[model samples]
Target: MDSLSQPFTFSQRAQKLTGSAIREILKVTARPEIISFAGGLPTPAGFPVEEIHRAFDKVLSEQGRVALQYATTEGYLPLRQWLADQMTAEGDVVSPDEVLLVNGSQQALDMLGKLFIDEGSKVLVESPTYLGALQAFSLYEPSYTSIPTDEQGMLPEYVSSPEAAGARMLYALPNFQNPTGLRLALERRQELVERCAAARIPIIEDDPYGELRYAGERLPSLLSLGRKAGATVVRLGTFSKVLAPGLRLGYIVAPRAIIDKLVQVKQATDLHTSTLTQMAVYEVVRTGFLDKHLPTVRDLYQKQCGYMLDAMQQHFPASAKWTHPEGGMFIWVTLPEHIDATVLLQKAIDKLVAFVPGEPFYAGADVKRNTLRLSFATVPEEKIREGIAILGKLISEA
Candidate 1:
């Protein structure tokens, strides 16, 4: 009965990720007065609540008992077909057989980790990439390597080098990337796909924010370019940004072989995402609500982004450098070299503002203590101005 004799010990992977600084900091940011630019959450105001209710009722009325029941691991056939058609329209040669539905793109990342990443296997990521992706892949214990990126996106020269070939896989957010909101340039996309193909490296192209473009011309997705280059690419997307996040609907487009593996992993993970939710989302897509609804969300975020950028220009110190995103929820800021964003968080929180420090985005070294991510997705235009003003004051004082 001694405490030392207790039989419970967590797995090594769980232990390795137990004290994530981001998760620990999230606890401190929950206060109501704190204007948080840390999380990549969409504003609840834009969720099409009435349409979702209608879609739910229609699905139940139309499908009866089937909507509530369990579904195949491959997902609702019509939704898969619709996604295939969308990809086709986007210039990707996709088929229904190549798609597998998941709870979210987050789950798609996890499933990809489980399917391909062995413990200690080398994986490549953008220098300041999506933190959730870092967290997901970390659970699988991959040896992560940070690839250099600029405002344009990942450096093609580095990605195509033999050093990159040593990695088991590369994860990229080609369109409106998280944290930075940087879009990968079209020429670089073509170069990356062709180079990775030549090096025989598979890419997991996570593109949840592609449809959220507010300005500028659309660039072809890495998946499309990969297809042209005859490469093996797995593309993950979500309805979260477009339709609603609560629906928890996302899908993966990959080779039929990779889809098969991911389906097996998905079956083990959550028994095929919610069939009810999938059906509801499918009905909404069928009704053409998505096509009409998404533009409104885009316009709202665009105005909000513009408001934040304007405020930053007016309020921020001359030394501060920030990315001007064409679309998406985030803006990455680089402060003076003497400033540590993590240390500044305490002061920021005391001033009722919060932002994610840039250090956690890196794989190992603390190269960017001067950096931070600001989100414009959740806050209104007025609040964005207030938040940036607060952040500016803190930075100037620091």
Candidate 2:
């Protein structure tokens, strides 16, 4: 018999998840000359290395062995308290007891999947949703249904429709959504809160890029709205966008009952997020550095977005339709109907430019092949212009 056919076998859940296609494609675009818009990564210049170093030194000096020791499954108290306070400022009625510190918002999705999704649970997603979340939830074998979306974001009419009656959960990124960079309108937010409340379906509001807004008035978070409507909403947030991704610190704010279940699930997953990293984040937040740092990040990304937008206007074919986001990292581009972005990837790669194809973002095989996502967050201003020009040339020739 073959070694692979031994008695021992991987869990059914592990067998279900196919690894992220974007991550695999990114591996091919790692060359120094490749101008990539395939990732949701933040610029290296925005990371607070000095502040993190200072916090690390203080954590070691003051907390010593405690910083490296095993911590509670609920996470560090001060970190939880700080997160609660931050959410409170955003108008969310969050208590420390109702918050769970996760490794990343990504891990929170996994925990939610473990806690809620059964083998055949129905989950609703925005069309062209975040691929990473799709990958995270796929392990549970949930049936995904993609709902139609517009510039104002996911429409509320679909959630309670007869077709979506069996959906256990709906996932959305209301502000500065990934791939599309579209924000949910304030009116739609209220509509969704009411509809989901009446239907008794929970909403997972993921807002990793909300704080990276560069323009327009800041809108209230879905959690804040959900609280007012008495709806069940689990809000996931992260420091990866405004702070640093390496810290791997994120949080989920939900009902105490849900938090308790998720905490148990988290305990089985990784025991807890890093105590040292959590302490560093706690210290950094306590010192009020984040308030000062956020504006700088917004300013840098705003200029980059503008550069890319200008280049797109100059280079892209007139038939190509693209979104001009007010804030956040991406621009969603739709090519002529006959084009397939995945097929075009090899040609773009040959020109040292790469973007994620939009097909994988959809929940099913019926995807718009002409669409692609461009990220302006990681590339420099000059590179954004150059890359868009190159991509435009490829589009024109195609």
All-Cα superposition RMSD per candidate: 1.7, 1.4
Candidate 2 lDDT over residue span 1-398, tens digit each = 77498788877766666878888988999998999999889999899899999999999999979999999989899989988988888788689999889899999998998888998899999998998889888888898877789889998999978878878899999998988999999999999999999988899999999988888999988889988998899999998988999888999999999999998899888999999999988999897888899999999899989999999999999999999898889999999989999989989999999999998899865589899999988898888889999999999999
Cα displacement (angstroms), candidate 2, residue 390, comes to: 1.2
Query: How well does each candidate superpose onto the true structure, as a TM-score?
Result: 0.96, 0.97
Which parts of model 2 have CA positions greater than 4 angstroms off? Answer: 1-8
Error of 2 at 395 (Å): 0.8
Give candidate 1 misplaced runs (Cα > 4 Å). 1-7, 19-23
TM-score of 1: 0.96
Q: After superposition, how far is residue 360 of candidate 1 from its true place, in Å?
A: 1.0
Report the lDDT tens digits of candidate 1 across residue range 1-398. 66469698767776677565666776888877778887788878779999889989988898869988888999999999999998898789799999999989988988888988998898989888888898888898888777899989999788776656678889999888888899999889998998889877899999999988999998888888898898789999999988888788899999999998888888888778788888888888886787898899899889888998999999999999999998889899999999999899989888888888998888756368999988888887778899899999889998
